[model samples]
Target: MHSPDSLYQQLQKIGTSPALTVYGEDRIELSGKVLANHIAKIANFLVDEVELEPGSRVVLDLPLHWKTFAWALAALVAGGNVVVGREKIADAEPGTVVVTSRPHGIELDSGDTVVALPLGSLALSWAGELDPGVYDGAADVMSFPDSLLFSGLGDESNASFYANAVPHVPQGRIGLVSPSVIEAISVGYSTLSSGNSLVIVGATSTADSIFATEHAESFTPPVRI
Candidate 1:
């Protein structure tokens, strides 16, 4: 019954049920506890390994996938500014932290940190050799603890990281599709705030079948026209 106002609060509202489900080449479902563990591990990796400073820019140069959402939440929870967009990705500063599925496409500069996530649902590590400096996101987070603690927390001033104008999502499992990563995150924020589980249909999957199987109500972004 708690209405979460911030990303951290929304994350804490996750219950024992399945929180996120992705229908793709392999159907992936993550319960509330498992999703929290993923976020904690990623947050620990960002803070402990990458040494992400408060208010630092963490660019998510990935598509609208479950892991992408997880990384975004983790960055915010770790006191970093979550940046999403190709323009932001291209103009990332030297010390910015980048998470992407296509690691090779990104050009790294001095002080920049990049973590590559595997496309395979079951992958524990990057299948091939990663560039010398890049971190394999799937492989590195496993060793971290499921809970996290931090000090001297900074305020989230960036408006991009918070939901804007998203409709209230009903409390239940719902299928969501959005035009952009930001919009997806907005809907996701609303979903989590309302204590609803989200089911994202992958490009390769049929929405009808996935929603039917998940018993999720289809939630399409309202047309502006």
Candidate 2:
């Protein structure tokens, strides 16, 4: 009632279902339990914590950092539209609350409300607040092996459909982590559930490359963790 945190749980309860991965056609099949965690995290942070009202446009103005991904997710969690342009694009005008950073400092002019959101720091704070239990694959129920396939849509304009198709992530779960080992979690589950043997190879930023390795490794039973 008073804040977004107040409504966090309520939002998560709404998004639990089978999700389609944006990476490709069948990257990872998720269930309700997994989707609930993501939405809950985002809702708690954006609605309850940041306290942004509905209809506010959050500019995801960070560089190619993991936090930007989280912020984008958080903005959606709070029911806010996102502006991914530079701070100058937002601040050149007036009466705008632009979420910028120290790196690309937006030269503030009169009447410009530049909100410097420390995305990196905020990510740490958010992660610290979460329970350690979550680090152990809060959503993964099993891994995959033989008969596994990997599919993705990617970051192209068409990728927006990924979110639309996959169950909405909880607001609180919309976040970023660099030191956060997502691939390990992903690989572990992929092999175990798919009944495919897996090999832990390095991951490249290229989605196709990463997916290729994951798919190639999923030909047998899982390699030991």
Candidate 3:
């Protein structure tokens, strides 16, 4: 496994390449690679500095941004747990992983004193100093020959592309599939955030399908690439 510092090195490498525009009416372009770095740094802080134990659950209550992505990566790298929740934060879990999104520019509902790691906290120091080039980016890890990580790229035919299309799952891997796109995206972020070194697994159990069907949840269906 790569050292924690390696994560930062990877971030410096990617700088800021867009990830999610963050879900909103007026979306701001964010960087995925930057998010990865920020997330890794937090993980380093929690593990090396705070000394959080493996599998320790830390609840997140922040808005969607590159920083959240960083936190997820940090949690995963730290080998801790994360939980996700909606706008209203709830009672945090003790042992397992927990993560969630809370409003930014304002206080959160949890009444919890959770602060984002690294850049989030660092930004506080430079709140005014920033040039307004002030968005956090997701960590950019491509399946670089040197780097083991890879994001399924936009085009497989591009030789320089780090990733190919999200490949078709072999029948054997279908058991790990998620029933819907939301689940897959959530699962994807979970993997990136958790840094558990486990692949972003897609859980599509019978119970899961039932829940999706009952709730009318739909996964991101395969579309023409």
Candidate 4:
């Protein structure tokens, strides 16, 4: 078995299992192969379309969903810094790439290249016409290949960071309830690293039923600030 040392490595280790199942207004299921394909598509888009270089800061201003998960993985796989949290993005320096699910009219400036995501599981384009200068993440990603050619530089330090952020229990079916986008991404990544799967819930009632139905080994609620 390969020891997961980075987000990319962790994703690769997931192999061909059902990696993530998200429950909310929309139900989405992602197998390991499908997840990897999305990750590759986004990663290639970041590198080729967005011109992201290694160590560049990519700000994710999106909700906790499968799309956010894919964006986070893609940023890591492209060797860019993944910046979570709304406050962090607000404070980010110029030249940062911001990925958002917000509507087209919102004013966003800071020398940042804004990429608008449709947030649809299999969307090929934005639902409505995008504002000029706003790149449609879904449409743009379609031009990229399904497999990423570049591999991330994985090491012990990267593994340690994820371990400390969210400890992984091997083969465990982890459950998350109302976690922020950052927390969800971290926990999901850790779970996959340990050869486990995730069940993410945004609604309390839905979460309770899923917990009982899935028999999740562990449950993590949103962090109280």
Candidate 5:
């Protein structure tokens, strides 16, 4: 078994297999190689375009979807700390970078950079007019090269950082039933760290079907709020 010290290191070992398969109103599939490219693009955008420094906090206010996964992975690869929640930008500290699906008409606090994600599989640009100062995630990411060389941070340091974020590690093919953004991120990252795949179900009723069809090792049903 290959024991990778960090989630990013594990992700680097995924190679070309299917890493994430999303089932919902839209069925999206991302292979490890393609996912890595997407992640690298986002990471480059954060580091080069936004000038995000190491240890900077990244506030994720997006849905439980592929875009969110890519954004989180990108942030981690860029050496930024990820804070997953549904909180508004006003609640975040100054200079914090916030990635969100909805940025239209929302007033952002000064010093905070907002990246607008369109959430489409191959969307090169946002559908509607974006507010001034709001960066288009897809557009900005496209400008960066896919091949990214990350260094400076060692394996032990990356391991320690990701270890605190992911407490419950998962192995093999895992399924989630209508999970929230934070839950999905945590569980998905854990699964990746263990060299496993994840199947995200959009509805609770389809949990059994997904499990049977996908041959999931474990299934997490939805919790009532």
Candidate 6:
């Protein structure tokens, strides 16, 4: 078994199979190589564009979508401490970077940097106008290199979310519908860490059909870490 100390490296080792299949407004499928590239693009954007420093907080105030997972992975790989979900959005500290689907809804201090993401499978950019200082996550990420420009992983002790014990997922195409973004990340991390592919549905109602279509053999949520 390959033991990678970081989430970035763990995902890098995934075999060239369908690493992620998301059923949202559209069906999006990503191979391991493609997923790694997407991750690299966002990580590079976070580091080079956002100027995210190692140990700096990156709060994700997004829904349970595939992009949320990608954003989380990128932040973790770039060594930015990540906070997933909307519960902590308002409390984000000044100078921290916040990635959200609802850029207009939140109230942020001037020192905070906001990256706005559109939650569609085929979205090339944020659908409409963004606040002057906000970063359009979909459009800006397209300009970064496919491989990581900066390649340092966060210290395990400092990354509280991923550093927690992950519940074991089966070693196959696993299907999941998590109650929260944190649980989703935990399941995603464990599935990839175990070198298994994942199929995530945007809503629990679609899980049955999506899982059957993807040939996912096991459905597990496990004890939320």
Scored against the true structure, residue 184 in model 2 reaches a CA lDDT of: 27
Summarize candidate 6's per-residue lDDT along 6-89 as a digit string, tens digits: 555656676477888877667788877777888889988988888887778898888877788888877877777788777777
lDDT by residue (64-134, candidate 3, tens digit) is: 44455455545545655554444323454333323322224533233223442233433433233222222
List candidate 2 stretches off by more than 4 Å: 1-42, 87-97, 103-209, 216-225
What stretches of model 6 exceed 4 Å from their correct place? 1-7, 13-15, 156-160, 163-166, 202-213
**Lowest summed lDDT window (length 10), candidate 1:** 1-10
What C-alpha root-mean-square deviation, in Å, does candidate 3 show against the real structure? 13.8
Q: Candidate 5 — which residues are off by over 4 angstroms?
A: 1-6, 86-88, 152-168, 221-225
Candidate number achieving the greatest TM-score relative to the actual structure? 6
TM-score each candidate: 0.83, 0.37, 0.40, 0.83, 0.85, 0.85
Per-model clash counts, in order, read 0, 43, 33, 0, 0, 0
lDDT of model number 5: 0.72
Global lDDT of each candidate: 0.73, 0.34, 0.36, 0.71, 0.72, 0.74
User: How would you order the candidates by TM-score, starting with the best?
Assistant: 6, 5, 4, 1, 3, 2
lDDT of 1 by residue, 63-108 (tens): 8777888887777668787888656877887689988888886786
lDDT of 5 by residue, 1-225 (tens): 122225555666787777888887877877777777887888778878887877777888888888898887778777767777656455776668988888776565677788988887779988888888889988877979886756542221132443444454456888777877766766676787777778887876767877788787655533322
The residue ranges of model 1 lying beyond 4 angstroms of the native Cα positions read: 1-13, 151-154, 157-161, 168-171, 203-209, 223-225
Tell me, by lDDT, which candidate is best.
Answer: 6
Candidate 2: worst-modelled 10 consecutive residues by lDDT: 146-155
Residues 48-93 of candidate 2: C-alpha lDDT, one tens digit per residue:
4444455554554555333344344344445554556673364443
